[model samples]
Target chain A: MAHDAAAGAQPDPSSGGWSREVDLPSERGASRLVMEELLEQLGHHGWEPTDIFGIHLAVEEAIVNAIVHGNKLDPAKTVRVSCAVTPQMARIEITDAGVGFDPAAVPDCTRDERLEVPSGRGVMLMRSFMTTIAYNARGNSVLLEKQRAPHAG
Target chain B: MTAHRRIDTSKVGEVTVVRFIDKKILDEASIQELGAELFGLVEQLNRKSILLNFADVEFLSSAALGKLITLDRKVKTAKGRLKMSNIRPEILEVFQITKLNKVFDIRGDEAEAIAAFQ
Candidate 1:
């Protein structure tokens, strides 16, 4: 599925130093390519390797969640990714045009029984990598942030 | 992005080396395919020593990590070992975060990886 281009327009640059919008299809290949581009852009902004890795994981998890879980891989819908980077932090939001679900409903990956399962680790990994994570009103949008550590901290 | 490539397996004495030339493994479908190939290879080959060369891979996702773990378990069940080499720092950090570093046998290069199987 594809997002309505007009409705999924890029975020305003006034909100942050850098911003971009991408329409991600249900195909894993397309979704992964969008993530790679996002990482490259973030890296060019001087993000550290750790920060880059964190953002990468967060983005991938969010996008995957949106495409697979939120949109249910429906070709008629789209997963939208928006990213904003500032001196203080970088925030990435992924939204899907689908029915929302409760984040608490997700199974814990830390538990031994669920570890071997092929899914359900994305949200946990995203939370671990991000400084803060929150769901939008519709629950289809996830906002992930990574604060730049103070030079001395 | 580098061109997608399949795993190249060759025998180094009794040990088998699986080289991954692709620079990234992010997609679930591809990772699943790779996992299946790895499982098939491990089954077809009776050798117990396996080395996965990742010199070309610059980034790896949790899905890739999961597949590695799955393959590791499969190999272990067959009384074999799975080792990795030439992991990029970025990818290594992902493994370290998940505490997989302690679970997988990782070496710096082909020589060291092969030496471990001896």
Candidate 2:
């Protein structure tokens, strides 16, 4: 509980929206269940299925980048997720306990020959799904923001 | 073993149909599990031609996308074909964004994916 920095801050449960810091272990399996719970909460707030799916996938990518690529899947290292959601938008920030990276250094997997490569597309997928995205100066943290679709109620 | 349970396979004529038993492919362990199963399909089973159905899937991590690409190459090296079918609109959007829609033989139905083999 020592690292539960988000423990003190919680969204009003009645609002149907949520804001909190969730401690994510670097292990692979536990994170998916946590991701689902977050999306389910957003779904209750009237986010469209597509919107929920997009944000969910983008969120997973960010977490994976943190847990695996950033922290090298070290179980001792934990990933921290700060998430806020409303019917109109969702913002998520993932911070890893590892060194950062340069976005420009990632190669383009969309090129004709590179399409089969096993990596390098996670960041691109994040960029595509999120309305806006950024990384911290240390490169270990990524912020992903997605706006709710205008037509979605 | 849980990852093994996540994917189910069936056959439609000469084409092998691979579908995820889970609704989401966002878990890292599942990705590694699928990777191994797909490799076995290409190397050991000698069943390289595949049609992956995404009708049951709603969400998948970018890590899953990279694994799919790796499987695509494995099947190709085995001289087999891989086609995708029944992808939900949102999942399709992810492919379109990465332009991977251009890389694999994507079809709308099992019949079309099977027909592509002929």
Q: Candidate 1 docking category?
A: acceptable
Top-scoring candidate (DockQ): 2
Give per-model TM-scores: 0.83, 0.89
Candidate 2, RMSD to the unseen true structure: 3.0
Displacement of residue A150 (Cα, Å) in model 1 is 2.8
Candidate with top TM-score is 2
**What lDDT is obtained when candidate 1 is compared to the true structure?**
0.76
Model 2 chain B poorest 10 in a row by lDDT: B1-10
DockQ of each: 0.40, 0.75
Predicted complex 2: CAPRI docking category: medium
State the TM-score for model 1.
0.83
